[model samples]
Target: MCGLSADKIQVATGHVEISTITNHYIKTSSTYQKQLLELGNMDSINSLEVNKLKEIIMLQNQEILRLKERLNLENEEQTKNANLNGSKNEFKGVVA
Candidate 1:
């Protein structure tokens, strides 16, 4: 029952793969077979390629977060400096 439930959830997740669809019709040497051939096979990319791509994405995300923190700190400092310079100056002989 657990296996059947798992299959149901798997199917519901919409993981219908291209290979599953391809095999369904390719036995007839259908036009789709030629199309798939032109598009190349999905079996080409290995686990290492996927892992490298994921690592690059993770690195980019970390860099973005670091930059955002730096910008926030700079903005806070600018606001503090602006407040310090924005106050009224002391009255001199020009006072009426």
Candidate 2:
């Protein structure tokens, strides 16, 4: 007895009847226990995969931010250079 009542087990397991859980699941067969263990392992494996994907997405987002910053810096530099050239051209016209 795992301390839970049959009714509780039936509700948790979503079985239609308490007798079904008592007859089918409450008895300990090695194969059933093994399957349960496998299910638990699968849950852990899926969690690990999800964590890995989240890390990858974070890295990608950081890279995108870095590229955007670099692009903005380049654009600012080009604008500054264009303004400098225009001023020089105007000064040359006045002198000539």
Candidate 3:
């Protein structure tokens, strides 16, 4: 019973963490978009700054995608684990 409760708590925490990450991603994305827009309008913007910003944005996007994929995989694995626990002791049986 406690294990189930703990699992629930862990899942809830993951969801909350993901939500926080998403909000942060949205905020950062908007800020970067504004920066990109400014780059288009400003003739004095440094090329080095533009390149750095582009690098950071690329890295951030990759990190966000990786986190999202991990979250989804965790959710899928947990759900599958729960479904396989009933009336069986063996794990990871072939899915039909």
Candidate 4:
């Protein structure tokens, strides 16, 4: 019975009617059932892998944003120091 309703079996097997499945396609093989279970397991494994990759990508993006902000702050500080040094040199030149 595969623990499934006749209508569900018919839909999955693409049979026109429940009677067709019960009459002609009712084979109870252990190997076939094992293969089906293995296929289901593969789907779950693939889903977990996909979720892990997405998490890694999100973390990387956050790190990139933090580094960019740090670079901008450093650049601004350098510009301010350069302006201050230029004014000091100009004042010394005028005095001498």
Q: Taking the tens digit of each residue's C-alpha lDDT, what string does model 3 give over 1-96? A: 233443454465564554454454334477887988887877655777778899999999999999999999999999898877853555335442
Q: In terms of TM-score, which candidate is stronger, 2 or 4?
A: 2
Best by TM-score: 2
Q: Specify the highest-lDDT model's number.
A: 2
The positional error of residue 26 in candidate 1, measured at the CA in angstroms, is 25
TM-score ranking from best to worst? Answer: 2, 4, 1, 3
lDDT per model, in order?
0.64, 0.87, 0.69, 0.85
Model 4 agreement with the true structure over 1-96: per-residue lDDT tens digits: 477777878888899976688666665467877878876778777878889999999999999999999999999999999999999999999999
Residue 8 of model 2: what lDDT? 82
lDDT (Cα, tens digit) per residue for candidate 2, span 11-88: 788999766887776865778879788777787778888899999999999999999999999999999999999999
Better of 1 and 2 by TM-score: 2
Put down candidate 1 lDDT per residue, 3-91, tens digits, no spaces: 34434544655546645433442252668668677556545455568788999999999999999999999999999888766643323
Judged by whole-model lDDT over C-alpha atoms, candidate 1 comes out at 0.64
In angstroms, how far off is 11's CA in candidate 3? 68
Task: Determine the backbone clash count of candidate 4.
Answer: 0
- By lDDT, the better pick of 2 and 3 is 2
lDDT of 4 at 93: 100
lDDT of 1 at 30: 62
